[model samples]
Target: MDAVPLLRISRPHRLSEEVGAVLEKHIRSGEFGPGEKLPAEARLAEQFAVSRAVVREAIARLKADGLLESRQGSGVYVAQCLGAGVFRMAAGVRGEAHPIEDIFELRLIIEVAAAERAALRRTPADVEAIEAALARMDEAVALSADGVRADDDFHCAIASASGNPLIGRFVAFVSHEFSASRAPTWSREGIVRGLAGAAQDEHRAVHAAIVAGDPAAARRAARQHLLRAARRLGVVLAAPPGARGEDMDEETS
Candidate 1:
């Protein structure tokens, strides 16, 4: 009988992520090639010096991500990875590789600059597009429905208004990534009173600055809006994506 392969985690900080990363690395490296069964939870728990619960959570994450699979009564096995190599080289999970704070920081840099450029370059058509998108976003937020798609349209319109396909494309990509990690942001805890109204006001400010062709004000408004949004999201991100945080209970109601 052959012994099960197991690896030890180095740093204990962010245990589930560390464990997940290690396992991910293994599957990606072909050490546990496609269709190879992974060691049982008990053995993995012993190797990592973590509890079975943590191991279960880590495995569950991989399975949810389409990286691994569990058969009926059989152990877990690696999934047939198609773009595994590209994904490994490109980026990691937003919640795991980098804190959600970095996502907001990225928006502060790219979206704010996009607004500034849009103010200088926006044509009549672009302005009209942005205005329409903003109106839809306002309605969606007011209804307390998930405004993520409308919010995306509003930001992407700004990028398109900049008259740069590259900027628009990049903004589109970033928007997808950001929402992938933090969709339905309006539903998070500690969102504060009238969050929808506040966000609408900020969007209007950005739109007004662009419409007035005031590049500086456009940048400033975009900055202030992202800063407020980051603060609210920071609360949600106090926990990892899809999990609850300690402080959330007080703010939940």
Candidate 2:
């Protein structure tokens, strides 16, 4: 009989990361179809030869990355395919020195429209989700500097409430972009505290407008929020080289 060689696999210190990688591979390979429910956690743990805690952590990470979704009393399912626009924004954040002004302008245009639509289309559940996100933002602000995450969550929730999956996906995409750019800025304690306060106020205004179903107010609030974000990035609004006034107005408008 011929001898079979044993394969050795490297063990990662973090079990969750290892599990996440395995699950991610399956997702990318299309082994799990879009919107397909994953097996129960216990079964997944057994199949992966890991603990349920590790499996749960892996699921949570994937969910954060907009790759998986969970339904109450149901199970985890693969997320729908995110459009190219969302992926393009996410792909642009790879150690490149992004122009903060340009990024803020893009965010302003997309998010304001998203807020307006959300105001017009949001359901009662969407309103509750936004309110919950607002509460989290307040909690994060009270707890201090790291509260910017809650602010991000609040905005992302509004994007999701727009009832347009692509909008939600784009929000998730740009979030990573903004985070990468702001990492240096947020490192300063003073900057963090100041931005946290500003974010809370902006989020409150947006939430109020959305709850009231006032699309115009929602758009204004969202636009103002992005403008504030641009200011924080120290970006000056200047005409693009060789562009005429009419051209600039047309582009921005």
Candidate 3:
């Protein structure tokens, strides 16, 4: 078999991401098989000539992406099926070849419905999780892009709150696709500078609608939020028949 090329890390920046790229390439290239245990953290650190923290971060990211799993007191092994489809989508975003707007469109369809359902179906535990995620989002917003994990957690909690296992799993599957793509689009610099506070206010609307068990309100808020995101990303809206530029503006407005 041909050798899999490794990513060359010339500059010492984001060692964890670089490490993840290297390991992901190897895994995709079949250098590592599913259910196979990864080398110990110390060995991986030595191989990459970086500290264990870097390796740990890389592994954490992979685990989050569902590419790997770890059992306490055991070892980290590749997850069954390895979720190559999700990985490819994430890789496309990372390469900047994927259209971020299109992904947002897909997210709009999935999340709006999910939010509506969650509002109707959420149990006490689901409400608690959603509130916790909202708190995290508030904290992240105050801190700017530093709140990526919290923002992500909020969405995941929403998925779970929907009370549909399939929906939650699907959302979790595509969650990482927006990590790099949507983060820059919704961060403090992005939202505050671009939307002039509309973005934050829109999120609040969605949260409130969900909490109130108002499905229609939730759907509307979710659609408006994603539409704003699509506009910010420069996505061209496909106008319906007899719909002019003014109509499009009115619809979005």
* Candidate 1 ranges beyond 4 A from true positions: 1-97, 180-184, 188-192, 235-253
Query: Better model by lDDT, 1 or 2?
Result: 1
Clash counts per candidate, in order, are 0, 0, 0
Worst 10 residues of 2 by lDDT: 82-91
Query: How well does model 1 score by local distance difference test?
Result: 0.74
Candidate 3 regions off by >4 Å?
A: 1-74, 77-87, 90-96, 186-188, 191-197, 239-252
Q: What is the TM-score of each candidate against the true structure?
A: 0.54, 0.58, 0.60
lDDT of candidate 3 over 14-60, digit per residue (tens): 98999998998787555887778999999999999999999999999
- Return the TM-score for candidate 3, rounded to 2 decimals: 0.60
Q: Model 2's lDDT to the true fold?
A: 0.73
Across 1-253, the per-residue lDDT of candidate 2 in tens digits comes to 9999989989756989888888877885669877899899999999989899999999998887767888899999987642212354433666465466667767766888999999998989778878887787577556554544555656677888899987876776666565544453344463455775676688789989998999989987887676666666666455458865653563455
Q: Looking at candidate 1, what is the lDDT of residue 242? A: 56
Q: Name the top TM-score candidate.
A: 3
| lDDT score at residue 63, model 3, on the 0-100 scale | 86
